[model samples]
Target: MELKINRPTKGVELCLDLEKRSQWETLEARRTELAKDPTIDQRLSGGPVTEVAREITQLEKEMAAATVTFTLTALSHREWSRFKTEHPPRKGDKGDEALGFNEETIFDAVIPVSIVSVAGPDGEPVEWAPEKWAPLADEMTTGQYGDFKRAAFGLNLGEAAARLPKSLGASLVMARSDES
Candidate 1:
């Protein structure tokens, strides 16, 4: 008999299209305002309302076409353990003492290690370095940064957690099904 084990070597890709996202948000707001106006006759405002909808659909297509994908790889168990040890929980009189990990500190430490590559909107490869993580994060909007952080964490930790069954019964069911 032969046995082989495969570790997780795959990277997760996350995409953010800021320009198109902002444009879509603006168009959505305009559409919402137009929707709320009780006095505006649909017949009279139809052209403007339709225009906004059309813009939204076009923007969706453009956003898909111009996606810049970021690839994040998981840290090995040993590397993850070392990172946790290096950034041990702080004990102090401050409220942060109760929280095992400081969110910002964790993000700072994890994001750089997890990011593997980035592709530009035009599908060209973009140069990236772990050292540039801070400056890149600073240039992003709050929402964009949050999203990037989430993707990094998800690739590192959340993927394993997400694979767990909801309960023991679910696990049993899955095992039994697999046996068949």
Candidate 2:
């Protein structure tokens, strides 16, 4: 069930019943609905044509101003302090907090790695298949792994056991399994 990598160490995979993120889908649907509605139509106005035209033109300007503008409120003091710890408050501390995620720079490094048969540096074709480690994916949205995020990745694993919820952490499987 693993999707082999293009080329690195053969990456592991798990068979997940992936589904669309509701947040992104809802945004798309709303955008489509808004585009279908015309807030001000110049052609629909009729009253001493020139006066109606002027009014319609003004309405068009206001309608244009109504375009979506995302306003991100400043993080609260507690949140700001946490963000500072994660992504520093000033330029000098950036390296210490954010590391490679510099303020002005994006995308740092990447090298293609084939998980299947590929020619090595010596020109010999090496056979490799990406290892597939199928840990059970949370099937229901209401499950413990409902969000399925990096933060929730290893709640069932050892180490950082104190960070997990009591009810959930107590259920982690600690048995050794060589099959995976």
Candidate 3:
């Protein structure tokens, strides 16, 4: 029987390319030099120092992009809707009514998905087709899901992903993937 197993994994690394690293290093040096300048007055230090700091930050981000690898997953329609509702900055211009998630909420959701790793059954890995893991992820109990969510919150998204089933009653699902 052809089968596939989806799992979550923890931890990721950010890599930087040589050119980006050089730019980041130059910015870092500029920032350090600005920080040590004794002649700069607090009032006048804002513009120059702030500009250098911002450029440094931008370079750092560019470096991370050059080196870090992030995974992307396609969310099901229902999942997408749920995510949007749960983490929101709804597209409306109502000053009094603000129903939306800030950076923290977005990170909470993104970190979890970014760490998910799907593997096929002892074969070439395939894209985790929709409706496969969704049913199982849905079958998980509320508390079990909470535990999983907590892991994601802690930024320990995918490590020891196998333990998910033990937390959720495995018997609930007849089988993870069905090949008819």
Candidate closest to the true structure, highest lDDT: 1
lDDT by residue (1-180, candidate 1, tens digit) is: 899533333333334566678889999999899877886666764567788998999998787676666777667768776776666676763533553455547778887877778787776788988998888777777876787777756655675744633788988999999999
Model 3 Cα lDDT, one tens digit per residue, 1-180: 989644344433324245566677787888788778887654674667788888888876665545433234334446545765676663453531352443235444654454444433233344544344345446545554454445444432233543544634554453553422
Badly placed stretches (over 4 Å) of model 2 are 1-20, 40-132, 136-180
Candidate 1 has a TM-score of: 0.64
* lDDT assessment of candidate 1: 0.71
Answer with 1 or 3, whichever has the higher TM-score.
1
lDDT of each: 0.71, 0.32, 0.51
| Candidate that scores best on TM-score | 1
* Ordering by lDDT: 1, 3, 2
Worst window of 10 by summed lDDT in candidate 1: 5-14
Clashes of each: 0, 5, 8
Kindly state the number of residue pairs that clash in model 1.
0
> What TM-score should be assigned to candidate 3?
0.32
- Tell me model 2's lDDT, rounded to 2 decimals: 0.32
Better of 2 and 3 by TM-score: 3
- Evaluated at residue 94, the lDDT of candidate 3 is 51
